[model samples]
Target: MPDIDDFLRNQERIITTRGWAVTHVLPTDDDPDTTAPFAYTVGLTAHDHPELIIAGLPPLVAHTLLNDLARQVYDKAERFSHGQRISDLIAGYDAVIIDGRPTDDLLPGAAIARYGRLRIRLQQIVWPDQQGRFPWDSGYNFDPHIQPMIAHL
Candidate 1:
C-alpha cells in the first residue's frame, strides 16, 4: 500500500493540474466498522464546494462516478442540495444526494488530512439498485450492509 505522504503528494499534484482528485477506499477484513468500500473527491473544497462522495460500489465504479460528477459540478458550477434528486447518473434510476456528515468514519482520510477532520463537508451521491429501489426502499436487491446510509445512520 502507498504511504500517506505519497498519497498526499498525488492528490496535490492532481488537484494542482486538474482541480480535483478521486480517492477510492476499500475496507480491510479486520476493520470492524468499515463494511463497505467508498470513493470521494479530494479537491472540490478549493472551489468552495464540498467534496463529493459515493459508497457501496466497486472501486472503479465509485471512482468513475466521483470523477464524472465532480467534473460536471466544477465545469458547470452546479451545486447539489440535500434531498435533491439527480437523474442523469444512472440511465433510469434516480439518485439522491444526502448531506454526509463529516465524521471520521464517513469522510476520506485524504480529504480530512487536507481539510482537517470535521472541517470538510461531503455530499453523498446515493444510487439506487437495478430495480430503481433505494436503500431505504423495500425489496432493494443488495445486502443491507453493502450500502450503509451514513447520513441517516
Candidate 2:
C-alpha cells in the first residue's frame, strides 16, 4: 500500500526479463499487530502453478526464500500441495504447504496488478516455531498473530 507503483513497475521489469518476479511486503496498517509480515511471487500461476506465500519472516528473508522456492516451481517444475512437509526450505524446522486465500489486504498490490485483480490462489509455506511446533500444535509458544492460520484449499 505504500506507493507500490514503483515496486510493481520494478517487478514487471524483472518478470519480463527473467520470466518471474518475487515481491516482499512489510507489515502495514492493514496488517494488525497479530498478523505477520509476508512475501509472495507473481509468476508461478502462469506456469500452471499456484503462487507461493510465506508469513512471519522479515522482508529480506522471505524474499530470499521465495526466490529459491519460485525457482523450484518454475525452473524445476516442482509443485507444492496441501499437507506436504518440506524440510529443505528452512533450517532445522520443517515447513508445511497449505492453501491460502488471496485477500486484498493480505496480498500486495504487485500480485493484484500482475494478475489483473483476479482471485489468485496461494500456497503458504508454513514454518514451525523454534520448538518445532506448528501453529495448530499444542503448546505452540510463538505468537498466534505472527502467522495467520491458513483456511485450507
Models 1 onward score TM values of 0.88, 0.85
> Please, what are the lDDT tens digits per residue for candidate 2 over residues 33-132?
6456888888776777788888888888888888888888888998888889999988887988987667643665566676755657788888888899
lDDT of 1 at 101: 66
lDDT of 2: 0.77
Across 55-140, the per-residue lDDT of candidate 1 in tens digits comes to: 88889888888888898888999989988998888777788998776654465778888887666788998898888888888898
- On the 0 to 100 scale, the lDDT of residue 5 in model 2 is 71
Reference-based TM-score, model 2: 0.85
State the number of backbone clashes in model 1.
Answer: 0
Which candidate number has the best lDDT? 1
The per-candidate count of clashes, in order, stands at 0, 0
